[model samples]
Every structure is written in structure tokens, then in C-alpha cells.
Target: MSIVVSLAVAVAVLLLMPATATLRTRSPSVLPAFVSLPSAPQLRNRLMHRLLRRQARDSRRRRSLRLVDAMVCELRAGLAPRAALLAATSTLTEPLCPRAAAAAALGGDVASALRADAASLGLPLLIGVGVCWQVSESTGAGLASGLDQLLVTARADEEVRAEVAGQLAAPRATARLLAVLPLFGLMLGSSLGVSPLGWLLGSPGGWAVLAAGVGEIAVGLWWISRMVARIERDLMGHVKGAQPR
Candidate 1:
């Protein structure tokens, strides 16, 4: 019974805690006509989904940076723009890479293909590459030079993100610690044979107290996550010199 109670409490605490999103590069989606705080389970699922998406986006951004660096190297080696793009993109595993590479090989509108893929895949870095490709083609500018400049800007943006993430780490940890403190309290009570869980789950007044405490903790964690996200977005805009859209 004690183990079961402990597991239940842990799961409840975990479900209530929202994951901190370090960056949001995209614009906010259009709101629904009606807005309301979702139920606890629904909110938990959405938080998990957002966390996963953020991880994937970060990974993709790193890959995109690598692609740019590789392209620069290839271009400096005297490869043509189309060939360099294809070669660099081939190193990536994303679906966008292959489609853009194919467009380059087929002499299609590679920039348009890149833009379309960027929009679909939520990879905004690709949009900059597309613009570089278009400008290089229209003005006879060196694509390599353009990409080199972009690489510098992208690296700066990356550094700002890293700094913001490091700064927010303590707050995120503190929030998690606070969220789990109640579990420790329960454990202490159980060790003392106080049967805290029994009281909380068994009695009407204890149930009310449990519900209220959980709700408040959940709201507190959510608020912290929101504040951190806003800080990340703002720092990225002001410090990195690129506003996320």
C-alpha cells in the first residue's frame, strides 16, 4: 500500500509539472475562438508534445548549422553552387534535405523548394539559405560569401540561445525541486508511521487539501515555464539580432 501510494503521488506530481521550453522560433499559432485552460491530463499531454517538438527543432537547427558550414567548405573547394548544396544536404537525414538536393540536381527552382520545405518542416534556418540562393542567382554574387556571413549570424544566434538556456537552468531545477518536495514530505510522514497518504486519500478534508495543493503547484510550475519561454524569445530577438517569426 505504501509503495502504491508513493507511485501515485510521484505520477501526479510529474503530470502536473510543465516542461520548460528554451526557445520558440516560430510565431504563435492563431488562437481558437474560445480559449480555456485545458484539463490537467490534456495540459500534461500538450506540454509533453511541446517539449518533444522543441527538442526536435533544436536538433534540426544544429544540423542546419552543420549543413551551412559544410556548404561553405565545399564552395571554397571550387564546387559549383548547385553541387555544393547537393553535397552538403546529402549529409543530412531530414526529408527537407533530400527534396532540396533533388531540386538542385534537376535544375528546378531550388530556392522555392527550400522555402517550401522550410515552411513544412518548421526549420526557419532553411529560409535564410533559400534567400541566399535566390540572391546569388539573381545578382551573380558568390553564394559562398553569402553563406559565410549567414554562418556567422547563425553561430551568434546559437551562442545567445546557449546562454539563455544556461541562465534558466537554475530556475527550472528549482521549480522541479519544489514540485517534488511534497513527495519527500509524504515519504517522511510514512517513515514516521504517520500514514499521510492514507489520510490524504481516505478523508474528505484531506482530499480537498490534496486537490488544492496539487492545483496550486501545477499553476506555479506553468507560470514559471511561461516566464522562462518569454525570456528566451526576447533574448533571442535582442541579443542574437534576429527576431523569431
Candidate 2:
């Protein structure tokens, strides 16, 4: 009897799990990630992946700063936030940057649109869109002033990114040069019939040189990350400014 009772209780708990999840789903605070719409159940996860890819692509092609400035300027033109976003994006000469405008016109959720758009990558734009949508939906706040603030943040973020890119310009070039420098030296030594293994394993002096090179490599990476983060702080500032509603 005791064993049967325990099994019954275990089954009962298992059954309640789904119910509990349903209840928790209704509460955004309890959810770990952003809430998903019924229209796209897997949207949040997909958006996150898209956002990561956008960040990666952004590093290679940095052309959106002017686009952000232009968008912000339009936002400050006393237009509705959604309309401004749509109109500004429609002016994009690129294939990807303008998608956000179409998404805006469709009244899609702001967060998802910004994250998934390949031609655009910034935490602030997403936030601004979200806040603007929520405010417009709930109450007619001073949208023009809100947009001015958003534009300022967007510009500041771009400036920070530009500064960091500038800072990394020299160091990144040096890193590439250093990476190939040793290979050339090794090739010269080999051509001259010098024993490469003697330097690789037999010599304490060579080992020390290798260690220093490794350390410098690490430091170079750290420098780039710190520079990017300083810019990211401005990016996140804009993002937070637009949080849910």
C-alpha cells in the first residue's frame, strides 16, 4: 500500500508539472527568456541567434553608423515612432538595414525585429522600438522628446563604436603582423639549415620568447575586448532605455 501511494503521488507531481509551467508562462518575471508570441513560438530563440550573427557580421562590415544617425534624426522629426522607423528604414540603400522598416510597418514586435534584422545590430534600437511601441499603445507620451533622447543615445553608441574601432586599428594590424612575423623568421632559419627543434625545445631563450609572444597575444585580445565593451556600454544604455514598455 505504501509503495502504491508513493507511485501515485509521483505520477500526480508529474502531471502537475505542465500545469505549473502554463501558470508560470503567464508571468514574464518567472520566465528566464523573453516571452514568445503565439504567432511564432520559437521566435525568441531564433532572434537571439540572429542577433549573435549580426554582431559577428557587424565586426567585418561597419557601415550602419550613418544609418543609425539618420534614423534618430527622423525619429526626432515629431513623427510617430513606428512611422518614423518605417520611413527611415525605407530610405536604406542596403538590403538588410531596411527590413526593420518593413517590420515596423507591419507592427511586429520591436525586440524581435531589431534582433533578427541582419543589416542592423544594436541593443538600443531594439529598446527604443519597444518603449515607443508600448508608450504609444498605452498612452500618448511626449514621443518627440522620447525620440530625441533615443537619437542622442544612438549617436553616442555609434561614437563609442567608432572610437573603439579606431583604438583597435593599430593594435589589430600589429597583431596580424606579429602572427606572420615568426613564420617568416622560422622559414629563414630553415632555409639556412638551422635546427628549428633546437629552438623549439632545446633552448630556454627561445622558450622565453615564445612565452612572451603568447602573453602579448593574450593582452592584444584583452585590449580589443575592453575597447568593444566601452562602446557596448553605450549600446546597452540605449537598449535599457527602451525596455518592455
Candidate 3:
């Protein structure tokens, strides 16, 4: 009788064990926790970084244009090419100014030095300057007139680019809004107690869906950005190519 009772207790305990396991599996704490997303500070920092980079690029372009205009003025005033270049460097800062001055003073390949400096600064206008210098050196042609024309064309190109950028502003904003719409929707659902994040973090199907959605968003943004950039580059290239070589 005692052995039979003992066996019955053991069987009961085994049955309870599965129930306990199931309960543990279904516990609230057992749900996969969502990873912490980037906080506001991190997002702000990223935005600041982007803004700084854009400003730096704009500043570099502006400085390069100014250098070209200054050189044109100095050249028109009857200074030699090397003298005009060195004078232009007076208004500018390193590394272009210092490098250019050194090259000019050293009596080395001034055009080549200018080209190198322009390349390092990512300034396309300076390429025209180098070309002007090279032509003057090789053929004894006047550089002042060419540089003046280049400056005029460059200004015109900048105006056109500004217009293009203005036109693109709306599209860019729309793309950004679309990229963030999913996040807003998720937040909305969460506010309504729908537990969207919980679902996304907790289940295999949800994980797959989330991954696909994120990938689609990223690819779409990348494609749009790439297309716009390519178009801008093509347009700029066409303009540059049309300029007097």
C-alpha cells in the first residue's frame, strides 16, 4: 500500500512539473526584452555632426571661390602669375595657402602644386586655375581673362545649384518623413496599449517582419539618396566639362 501511494505522488509531481515549466515560459518577464534604441541626445549629436560637415564643405567651397576671384583681381592688376598666387595666399589660410606659397617660392611646378592643393581641398574651381596657369606657362596666353570668365561661370553654376537644391528640399523632407513614419506608427500603437514593440521583440514571425521592414526602409532611403546624388554629380560634371579647358 505504501509503495503504491508513493508511486502515485511521484506521478502527480511529474505532471505538475510540465505545468510549472509552461507557466514559467509564459511569464511576463520571459518575453524577449526590446533593445534600447538611440536616445534623444544621441540623435541630436548625429544631427549636429551632419550639420557641421555640411557647413565645413560649404565653407571650403566658398574659400576656394574667393581665392580664385582674388587671384583674378591681382592678375588683372598686372602682377605675375606667381606674384598673384602668392598675394592671394595672403588672404587665405592653410593648407592651400601655405602649400601654394611654398610651391611658388620654390620655383617648382606651380600649376601642379595648385592642382594638388585643389584636389586636396576638393575644390573643382581650382582645376580651372591650374589649367589657366598651365596654358599661360606653355603658350604665353593671357590667364586673367580666362580666370575672370571662369569666375563668372562658377558664380552662375552656384546660382543654378542653389535653385536645384531649393527644388529638392521638398522631396528630401518627404523622404525623411516617410523614413520616420513607421517609428511614429509604432509609438502610436504603443500609446494605445497595443504592445507593438513587445510583439516585435517576442516572436519569431514578428522578428522576421521587423527585419524585412527595416531593410526595406534602409534600401529605399539609400536608393533615393544615391539617385539624387548621382543626378547632381552628372549635372555638375556636364557643367564642368563644358567649361573652357
Model 2 accuracy (lDDT, Cα): 0.54
Whole-model Cα lDDT per candidate?
0.77, 0.54, 0.72
Model 1: what TM-score?
0.77
Q: What would the per-residue lDDT of candidate 3 be over residues 99-175, giving only the tens digit for each residue? A: 66787888888888778877887888888888988998899999898888889887888876786677678878888
Model 3 lDDT, residue 243, Cα: 64
Ranking of predictions according to lDDT: 1, 3, 2
Candidate 2 per-residue C-alpha lDDT over 140-161 given as tens digits, one digit per residue, 9 for 90 to 100: 6765566566666656655655
Answer with 1 or 2, whichever has the higher lDDT: 1
Tell how far residue 124 is off in model 3, in angstroms.
Answer: 2.1
Displacement of residue 244 (Cα, Å) in model 1 is: 20
Top model number, TM-score: 1
Deviation in Å, model 1, residue 15 alpha carbon: 8.3
Off by over 4 Å in 3: 1-54, 230-245
RMSD of each: 9.6, 21.6, 15.7
Candidate 1 accuracy as lDDT: 0.77
